[model samples]
Target chain A: MATNIAKIACAVAFAAGVAAPVTAAAKSSTVTAIEERGTLLCSGHNGSYFGFVEVNDKNEWKGLDIDMCRALTTAILGDPDKAQIVPLSWAQRFPALQSGDVDVIIKATGWTMGRDTEVGLQFSLPYFFGGTQFMAHGDLGITEAKELDGGTICVEAGTTIERLAGNYLKTLGIEHTMVSYEKASELRAAYLANRCDAFAAWGPFLAVLRATELEKPDAHIILSDQLSNEPIAAAMRQGDEEFVDMVNWMIAALLIAEEEGVTSANVEEMASNPPNPKIARLLGVDPGMGERLGIRDTWAKEMIAATGNFGEIYDRNLGEGSPYKLERGLNNLWSHGGVLYAPILD
Target chain B: MDAAALKLRRSRRDMLVQTLLVVFVVLVIWVAISTAHTNLTELNMTSGFGFLERATGWSYSFSLIDRSIDDSYSKTLLIGFLNTLFLGLICIVLSTILGFAIGTARDARQLGLNSLATVYIQIFRNLPLILQLVFWYAVLIHMPGPRQAFTMGEVAFLSNRGLMLPGFNVSPTVVLAMFAAVVLLAVVIFRQKSLQPVQKLLLWLVSGSGAMLLLAWIFAPADSSIFSIPAQQGLRFRGGIGVPIELVAMILAITLYGSAYIAEVVRGGLNEVPSGLTEAGKALGLSSRAIWFHVKVPMALRTIMPPLGNQWIFIMKATTLGVAIGFSDLFYIVSTSITQSGQTLELMGLLMLSFLLINYSLAQLVNFMNARLALKGH
Candidate 1:
């Protein structure tokens, strides 16, 4: 009798184990999951990436990436406050997303072919454009990156900047050593301590550091050469076409809103009295855009009202409205001599 | 029932139970692999060891082997393993010596010395190792830069970059001769009682030849100078062996932390030694020094070996703290590989296997030493 009961228990456990993955696979979309959980998990930087992702004096997250995460959360769950930021290191971001620790990776992640194909990440449309550059001490008397020979260069590990810097140096036939740290804070510390001759990182981040973190800002010189132009985007796990499309269009709505002269303050006015069909459709006055994407018809309006348009976000975090006061450069609108454009929303 | 019949039935039951256990474990493993495979396929990620052959377009700060952006992942990982092994071995040797000294000092008759040893152990052993590592790293990097390096008679330079020492330009033949001299010295020391007269004479000849080769290499003509002193060039010191600051900081932290633990192990082992044996040695007219070395240490070693082995393994594992300081050790390399190659499972498996092989060898060595030092029966 005991043997029979043991056999039955073992059989039941085996059956349950076999059924688990199948049930997990049958789940339809990430949107439903977010709705059920009532919070949208978005990735944030482990340390401050000033102007992109950092805390303010008030101890609140305020940056371009943080605004993007809030916009995504608002679009999905209709409340920006429902966003939960999960801080992750550069190496931990991919694994965190793959293991379902976060819903979307809105960190300042570069879209590379290796990350796209090999790492199994599905990226949304490019939201920000930037370039990689090097910063060196003024005492080195070196003006160009090519002059940094037989010196050590510090960079953040598990980043595209590390690879780009190495490749660029090798292409110029310059010999140097590369040291990488896992956190931006550690990299900054090493560079400041003069442990390495030069530091390599994203261009805007280098500028921000020079302006804010450095006591003697003129003591360091950012080299003029652009190593590589990176298209920064949001990454999610693959095999969810509906979720990917929603995120992609959510980014498009922001750009279109910016181009159509719609601000967070004027979004409600524009929706109530849109002069053209494009603005009407974008603000959900026509109602088909949101239904097709499996969301409320006023999703775009809610998202814009929560996190303003793309231009406002750029200005508030990184451009004239912030301490960095950086130029838009390649991040400007397509009509204004930039590469960013959204497809026509019909 | 007969006793033999009952024994046979019990053996049959044991066999059946063992078979069931094996089957259950195998089934569980199979289920796990299948699930993982299915999930990976759905995510469009490949899972295999094939990614090891792909080019790793990154560079490490310090590597024993020649590496480049074009090198394959396998080569990079091998260099990382070598770096870790080298660091672990150096720390093990230094900590053992330091631990023995401190442990002996702890048992000293002098109160001040004993208290000093006690304080050192308490401070280092109680502090977290990661904090210690970060502290040492901060101290090292805060030193003066290369241009203002603290020079040791211009032969060696200490700077935030590293301790740059004057390197030798010896030929391969000189290195080979030096190796041969060490091997011959070991043979002479280990087999002195059993060596024939002719063998001893041959050993002497080899040692003499090795010494002559080294002297010749050292005194080669002025144009072919054997010493390469570090001199400031461009952004750093050139023409000498440059040891990066990361390696120095990692070794210092691991050695200090590991020594504290090992000192305690030594103290326990020595305390547990039978005091009657020391009294016996004294009664036999042994001198104080002779009694301490010949009576106390050997007996303590038998008890010390097992725990000392554990400390050695722990020290090796602690080398992973290299990542915190950006020392390009095996764990750091494998983690970077996971991000670059996206073969997380395979890379992680490789890392675990490599560490297991390393620590297992260390454990076996400890066991062998314990056996050799153990008390023997008549």
Candidate 2:
């Protein structure tokens, strides 16, 4: 009887210990440090890969990640000026975060296992979803990435693109050589020099490169086939649950903005009026919604005013207004049959 | 009556020496580790070595190993270590040669040669090594495409991507012949060492090496057929050696930077040697070159060994600049390893340890050389 009771006790103890993790998992996510600092610290790339991250004539960073930072800043501080963007290369991004150099990283990073389990980071939510693709100079008549058998490729160092490209080549049983350089500039130099048969990179980047950097934009074409589906997100150090939630909700808000008719031009008027109870709540026409997120009722309104609506942001940073000229495909609202779908506002 | 005096006498010397010894030990360790440990852990991160086993599923643009991102971070690090070693060995040999030329030129009487030496040293020394690296990379990477690549006699090729040339693709017959050549060279060197004078032995070695190389070229049989990438196509290249521009830049930086300082050291060492030593040798009917070689430089070697070793540590540390060009040397690979493993502290420690090992080994080598070559009476 004593042994059985002890056994039962041990089982109960094990169950309790296992169940204890629920609170621990929920506890580390406080965005208080970010709120106190009054700025969203974001680390991004230095290059003008175009539409992604680039420095303007004044030498300030501006791009998709920059816009996201603006949106989050407006959400938290009721002012867009509360966001600071720190530039880092592929090698510098993680160390900066691990050392508290930056609050979060929204650089062009793929959500990988090592980054999560090994690095002790929380990848809050994927903002931009895409994959690796290859592009060849049109004159080579290399229609497919597979057609470049025994050809050479140029890629940047500290990226997953090289591995992905190699995997595809291996699958097709084609012989190829991959040359890498430390910076994007070096890779681009090699590409322009005609050292590589193809330049392998992300889809959006290829489009941006063609639009902006090329001497003749139409001289090259990106292969339609994607080698990998990368779900990139804003990342922060583990144990900052509140900050993670804030960034996660910020990404969801972008989808919600698309779902609603809240363009940057029309957001002010819409916030004043009411199409639905949800928009009023989201725009803080109602009082309770903003409090739940630990912000002022005018938080959404300020965010919209600072960076424009989701549609405006996309258009400005990556769409028709920007040089990339990308169409909103799966990134559109669920009602429009794209991948973006945010939950209904409470 | 004498007890107090004795106590005072012992303590003043003992306590001071003890204190000095403790301070030295503590300070050395503190300087070695405190910064890396403190800066890394403050952000809720811990340092340790658990990251070596985790999967790294990425591929490098330039790799010595068949690494995929799927391989362990440890593998990438190993590959990077090998690259650094190859670069270090090459730069050491090249800088030694360049240093000799520069040191010789500095005091030379020939007006044109002196001016050229001065120009070479000024140009290379004035430019930052990293800037030089970037410049070299820029020149190489921005060149026109392969079809438009500069070609020499339809054999050597250069393009922005990388240079491709005819490499010896080795067959089994070539391997056997290489082994035979190695054995023959070894036998020749052994005979020269055992039976001949030093000068005569050196002559024998040069001839032996030349004959072996000639035979290998003839028997190893490089394909005069269509050229391939300078690196081996399937595995590693046997005959065709490709020095990638990234590697070229790093070597250039390390060698050019290191050689300038070495030249200064050599000059200083030579100046310290008594002029009478050479005059004595000449009086004894020894040649001027032989007098300088057999007596002066050997003595100078002892005086300069420690500083040379210190420069080597700097060279090893400066190799971290390879990160800029993506050569994946110790620093570059360590950073990537940190990124993949999330074991930042452990990997950082590992990196420091690796550098410590490299520095320690180089120091040991210099110390050994200094000890063996130290003057007998001193």
The number of the candidate with the highest lDDT is 1
TM (B chain), model 1: 0.90
Native interface contact recovery, model 2: 0.43
Across residues A206-262, which tens digit of lDDT does each residue of candidate 1 receive? Answer: 879887989987788877667878899999999887788888988999999999999
Among these predicted structures, which one has the highest TM-score? 1
Pairs with steric clashes in candidate 1: none
In angstroms, give how far residue A329 of model 2 lies from its true place: 9.5
Residue A308 displacement in candidate 1 (angstroms): 24
Error of 1 at A178 (Å): 1.2
DockQ of each: 0.59, 0.22
In Å, residue B300's CA in model 2 sits off its true spot by 3.2
- Give the per-residue Cα lDDT of candidate 1 at A326: 63
Candidate 2, DockQ score (0 to 1): 0.22
Per-prediction share of native contacts kept: 0.86, 0.43
The candidate 2 chain A region of ten consecutive residues with least summed lDDT is A22-31
